[model samples]
Target: MDRITTQAPALVLRPWDPADAVDLVGLCQDPALRRWTNTPVDDEAGAVRWIQEQQRGRAAGHRFAFAIVESRATSSEGRLAGHMVLKNVTPGGASAEVGYWTAAHARGRGVASRALRALTDWAFTTFAGDGLARLELLHQVDNAASCRVAQKSGYELATLLPAAPPAFPRDGHLHIRSRSAQVSALVDATRR
Candidate 1:
């Protein structure tokens, strides 16, 4: 399982490791990251716990979480760039939800979109026979940046979801990309 590193054109998606606690903690310090997702890394202990949770989730075939790393020749090589996950995956189910948050330093660099597309392809391939068909990407309606990332990753707007406070405090948008989709024009825009 640890050997399951996904190679994207510009990023590497690997499982979270204990040694990444410091960087994860630092990434969580960015207010925007904290504001968008329920990050578990507030400190080193929390980071370790979060990493362990990811490990257990992976072992149980429930969640597939990855620590995004830069692989660009000119990029900050090996730097922790973001977190991405395919959650709510049910065996023999047709769909699952995807989520991610780019580190403050990694924002505006296409980190989320690249990592998302790469891992999405991985998930579809890995679960090809398990009936997995669509990966849903949801973000609060106010998160314009996430919207752009979703579009750039080939996920099209599917619907609007009403807010459920204390969890999802804002109305949200649901984007879905089917396993058979061709890379979209929005994704082509990102490629340029």
Candidate 2:
């Protein structure tokens, strides 16, 4: 497993830990987040479980979850700004789905977009050996903010998926980003 630690000018993307459970609880309490994700992290135990589940998923090669931390100089430095993940990874790593949520305070600061971009870059660069070829992001049809994030992260709106069972039980938009030709060329050059 790759220990991913990607940094941007304003944020850092690292693995989520047990120490982040408290912050996760608070983030889950935000009504807007709840409405979007339908997560079960309303309390400490749930938050712990969330962290544990992410670890398990990573160990199983099913997902890679990250904590979005801001690079600040104040006491709140390193606070949990949000969560981002590459989930529903297919066997053989041909593709994966990206998902994210911003904490209430991080909502308008472009945290989600920046972290997502960093995560996408890392995934493409690190997972080519595992056969990763593309990544996808999906959001409810009415989620304009998420749409903007997808666009900012270089994912193109591919299609509209009708309300389906389980994960997306509502109409949604699918966004996709394939491993770019430049990256593929670079990989080939390195191989030679």
Cα-based lDDT for every prediction:
0.85, 0.83
**Poorest lDDT segment (10 consecutive residues) of candidate 2:** 1-10
Tell me the number of clashing residue pairs for each predicted model: 0, 0
lDDT of 2 by residue, 131-162 (tens): 88889999999899999999987799999999
List the candidates' TM-scores in order. Answer: 0.88, 0.87
Model 1 per-residue lDDT tens digits across residues 29-64: 888988899886789999999999998988889798
Best by lDDT: 1
